[model samples]
Target: MGVTRERAIERLAGRHPGRRGFGGSADPAEAAAFRHAMRGDHDLNPGVTPPSTALTPAAVLVPLIDHRDGMSVLLTQRTAHLTAHAGQISFPGGRVEDADPDDVAAALRETEEEVGLPRDRVSVIGRLDTYITGTGFEIAPIVGIVDPPVPISIDPFEVAEAFEVPLSFILDRRNHQRIEREVGAHNRAYFVLPYEGRNIWGATAGILVNLAEVLAD
Candidate 1:
């Protein structure tokens, strides 16, 4: 069974188990304003700039809730053949094309092309903050609500598998685990959510952390 609209909304509204410092506690108005500023404007975070000089524009489609289990977020694992971030868990998206009018359109178009998810079936709610990846792509994360019972076809060349994680599980503050690792010559700290068999970390996890903060507020 697919998730219903009411159930999805309820899940988003419910308290998240993984609530951490990353998920700021603020009033709805303040939180909404922060989210809006982050999404609308690019320079919200002036201190943390892109590490690389390359600037490829990309858009990620964050599908929230497919009907059967109320509200679940869809994610994908990229095929190892990819040049960048191969074998990493990520949202369905890619570099924007000249044919796409804007970021949102590009995201929807890419989702359809990569995952066989029809654009018409997705209702975009809003966008999250843009993230500058270490690999040089400036990614705009667009959150959308997908109706249940929709069929999906995965492109074997780009996507290894497609799966859904309950939004509630993602939203809960307790599930967000913080850890440190050595990257190159420096130590790096990040969040990780080990869902099913997939280890969602790095840029993908950072995006989810931002989303969790917004939803918690």
Candidate 2:
């Protein structure tokens, strides 16, 4: 939290845009575009100081597992020893590399490297707005539908564990909570998705909110 904390704005989850079928359709193509794009709300978290600092471009894959009952979002818990975002739940991704062709490639590559989820197993459908983090990262979130029954291996160095949270649970406004705290001279406010005992907050929560808005539209 920083000087830019604002009241929590939870977008209501409703009918899915472009949904041709009824009852929780997991159509990746239908869930592509959002009515309005996200701007990495400054009031949510004023990222680095001097706003002029060079930002590292990154990408993450929002893996929607196509389960029989419904879809679930695949997320990972970073190892506590990591320098950045230690012990936090996050999407499998990292800073975009020069060898990466685009955001999609970066996301898929990072996901494979971090969680061993093959690109072939992922049906990349669309992308969400780029989210800028307080740590000076420009993150592009790529939404992909993953076919289940695939064995996922985790990178012990970076990822501590991998788990799936139901998409329905995440989209519901009743589950999203706004938490605030005083950081130095600023009052910081951010979204939190507390599932079971897991605390999903910060940029991760922000990205989920963006996804919820897109699906709700």
Candidate 3:
């Protein structure tokens, strides 16, 4: 039988053993390996400071849904006209506002504003580590579970399309490709997952890669 919404929430809420709940199940050996690998990366280091002068705090909602076959993650493709990361696959989010009290609030508010997902329908499980992007924003990733069969209306000005990718396909290391390029004076390394003519890269890819590493563990 497939995992029900209650079962998934129970797992995330620490009702299950050795499982840091998000949306997927993790084997003991895989979790250990992922932790070991994450420690070596500077970006994953919690102490590293972000380079951007704009102290704009941002929150992103990483929506995980339970499909009959398996789990899938909801992502959005930004319209080409956007000023920032245009034409990139990303989680629905934006800068924190004075009206928003916390990361979860900001994420929910942004999701409603950007994608027309009602705030009340989402059940927030917990949060992952905070990731600092090179682009001048400290991003907090809020993981949440949405009851399936909910309707989504996309805002064309901000989101070109909203789609889901099987979480299992992303968790596999084989699909995660590392690329090297020179950014200014330094050689930078990043990840890219090219799917359906869309190039998933940069900070967006980094966030997914981190989440994948966490779940794979």
Best by TM-score: 2
RMSD of each: 8.3, 11.4, 8.2
Error of 3 at 142 (Å): 0.4
lDDT of 2 at 22: 17
Q: Write model 2 residue lDDT over 112-195, tens digit each, in one string.
A: 999999999987767776776667676788888876785699999999999999888887988889888888997788899999
The superposed Cα distance between candidate 2 and the true structure at residue 51, in angstroms, equals 2.5
Model 3 CA lDDT for position 86: 81
RMSD of model 2, in Å? 11.4
As for TM-score, the candidate ahead, 1 or 3, is 3
- lDDT of each prediction vs. the true structure? 0.71, 0.73, 0.70
Instruction: List the candidate 1 regions with Cα displacement exceeding 4 Å.
Output: 1-49, 52-54, 66-69
Native-to-model Cα distance after best TM-score fit, residue 138 in candidate 1, in Å: 1.1
Instruction: Name the top lDDT candidate.
Output: 2
TM-score of 2: 0.79
Model 1, residue 170: what's the lDDT?
79
lDDT per residue (tens digit) for residues 8-103 in model 1: 455445332221111122565543343333322123233333432335678989898655546788999999999988999999998888898888
